[model samples]
Target: MAIPKVFITRRLPEKCIKPLQQVAEVKMWSEEYKPVPREVLLQEVQTSHGLLTMLSDRVDETLLAQAPQLKCVANLAVGYDNIDLEACRLHHVIPCNTPDVLTETTADLVFALLMASGRRLIEANDYLKQGKWQEWGPFLMAGADIHHKTIGIVGMGRIGTAVARRAQGFAMNVIYHNRRRNVEAESELGARFCGFESLLETADFVVNLIPYTETTKGLFNQNAFTKMKKTALFINAGRGATVDEDALYQALLEGEIAGAGLDVFSQEPIPKEHPLLTLEQVVALPHIGSASVETRKQMISLCCKNLMRTLAGEKPITPIETSR
Candidate 1:
């Protein structure tokens, strides 16, 4: 029997490709670090039986319509906002994402960003690098206190619960707001469920872990920033679309909030002219939430496994249920 063809959108770790190659004819774009162009992706999908893609690729209806032999799309990340689900369903393409694997890793990054922003770590580092630290003054490099403060988690899912657990270590109070309260999470983590407004009003530090959905798109606007305390630090480890970038820029410029740490952005590779880039209070990262060597390897392996199983007519280990 002829083996099926699999096209990986970008270059992945050798371990991830090895497993897939065992079952299919794998063709990977040699340049893994950069995003594959749209024209190239469309051309590759034409003859592929399965596609392994990352968040960078926008798998829309037009691309789906061209892939007659495509059986499954295994997204390497947890979020699926880049891919059009309705188009997948219409084309009978199975859409899958790697969830649980990166939950803890992402949570760790959230806490890291929260602490770094709250304490002005980056700013202080710059001060030292610029040879400006002549001597330590009584009030030099002062930042907000993190311990024993209230932390408000915007979304109480797996990543949220993980972040709350870490907060407990600092003797901090964990308050959260979700679509619906998870009684089990409350009991296990001692997480207090509150309304969205209350969470913003009471938290000393606000952490956004909500996934990007139709309802959550542009959820964090000027009004939301205005609701937070002036001393409150904001951290985002979730999808960038959840925030209105322009509104956030205005809030920061106007001192609506103290500081912010952003892992993702409205646009990847944010332009040099972007207003947010000019802010001193913002600590920006290039979306490395699951960049840990071990975690990334696992995520890639899972995506390849999901693709192989779905193509082989076997149930995928982590199949995304559209009904939910």
Candidate 2:
């Protein structure tokens, strides 16, 4: 049998690349850290049977049209918003994503961002670096308390449950709002289901873990921020489009909320002059939710496994439902 041609968008770890190369003719785009350009991607896909893509790549109808031979697309990340599933269906292509493997790692990042924002960790470090911290005063670098506070979690999925489990150590009360309440979550995590309005109004720390969908786009707007307490801290480790960036800027500037910790944003590599970058109360990171060395390797391995399975005439390990 002829070997299937596989195209990897970015250079993955050697271990991950080796397995795929053993079974297929693999061509890597070479640069491990940056996204591959659209023209190059379209050209490469024309002859490829499988594509291992990252979240940064936008796999739309036009791109799919170029790859009539493409059988499967395995995304390295859990979020597949970058891929247009409808187009993939029309093209008779299977789309897969690495999901469960990175859930805990991403949850850990959410907590780290939450603590950094609530305790003003970034601002205090900058203060010391700038020689502004002469002596520790009673009121110096004071910030919101995280322990024993009410935590409102939006989108109570696997990651949200993981976060709630961690919060148990702090003896924090966990209340969550989901599209539909999970009875198992309530019994297992000691989480109480609440309405969206109540969650925003009552939580001391509002953590967003929802996926990007038609209903969830721009869910956190000016009105949602206004419902939060002046001392409440907002943390998002979820998709960037879930929050309105302009509204978030205005909310922080006007003291609608105390602070924000954002790992994901509406734009990746947000411009230096972006208003959110100028605020001391907001902590932003370059979208590294599942960035732990071990977790990333596992994610790549899973993506490779999915692609290999589909190409070998077996079912994908983690196939996404096209109907949803």
Candidate 3:
């Protein structure tokens, strides 16, 4: 009998690949930075039994239709928006994501970015590096304060709850808006449930942790930004498309909102000339939410294990519900 085959979209650790190798023939795209070309990925799925993909890869209806033998997809990141879950269900393909393992790490990054933007950490460092820190004034690099301020989290999942815990340590008032109320988060974290519009108006720091979905796409348009206080800070650690990029830029430009700290953008590796990058008030990162060393290794391990389990006629470790 021919060994089952698995195609990995990007290079993973040798140790992570070893276990998959024992059960199947493994093929990997050797680059770490470049995404596998769409044509190449389609060609690979023709015969592969399982696929290990990253957020950069698109596993859509068109690709799924061509992959007759493919049984499982283990997405390395916690978000599976890149994959078409409905298509997977129609094709009888199981999709899994590396969640829980990266929640704390991502939450850590959210707080880091919040602090960086609120306190002007990056701007201050650049000022000193440019030899422009000759003298100090009372407000030389002064920025917003995090303590005892209201923080309205847009999503209340594992990562959101973790972020609320961090907000607690800072003594910030935690409020949240979710599709459904999360009682545990309310009781344990002292989070108050509120409507989306209300949250926007009241929160001193408006943080978005919501996942991307059809309903959430372009949710933060001009109207949403206009509703926020001119003194409010906007932070997004969630998917980029959730907020309208153009609207966000205008908000920063017009002082409709104070500033923004964004880890994800509508386009990855945003162009240097992108309007958002030009603003001193905008703190942009390259979507490194779960990028801690230990968390990355754990995500890889979870993804590999999920793929292996699904191929061996067992359930995936963190299967996504296609019914949504």
TM-score of each: 0.97, 0.98, 0.98
TM-score of 1: 0.97
What is the model-wide C-alpha lDDT for candidate 1? 0.90
In order of listing, the candidates' clash counts read 1, 0, 0
Q: Lowest-scoring 10 consecutive residues by lDDT in candidate 3?
A: 11-20
lDDT score at residue 198, model 2, on the 0-100 scale: 95
Residues 1-324, candidate 2, lDDT per residue (tens digit)? Answer: 889999999987777678888998999998977889889999999999999998899999999999988999999888999999989988989999998999999989989899999999999999999999888899899998889999999989889999999999898999999988878889987999999999999999999999998899999999999999999999999899999989999999999999999999888877889999999999999999999999998998998899899999999999887774
lDDT of 3 by residue, 3-67 (tens): 89999999878886788899999999989888999999999999999999989899999999889
What's the CA error at residue 154 for candidate 2, in Å?
0.4
CA lDDT, candidate 1, residue 50: 95
Per-residue alpha-carbon lDDT of candidate 1 for residues 1-324, written as tens digits (9 for 90 to 100): 779999998887776589899999999887877989999999999999999998999989999988999999999999888888888888888989999999899889989999999889999999999999999898888998999999999988889899999999999999999999978779987899999999998999999988899899999999999999988888988889999999988888899999999999989878878888888789999999988988999999899899989989988888666653
Pairs clashing in candidate 2? none
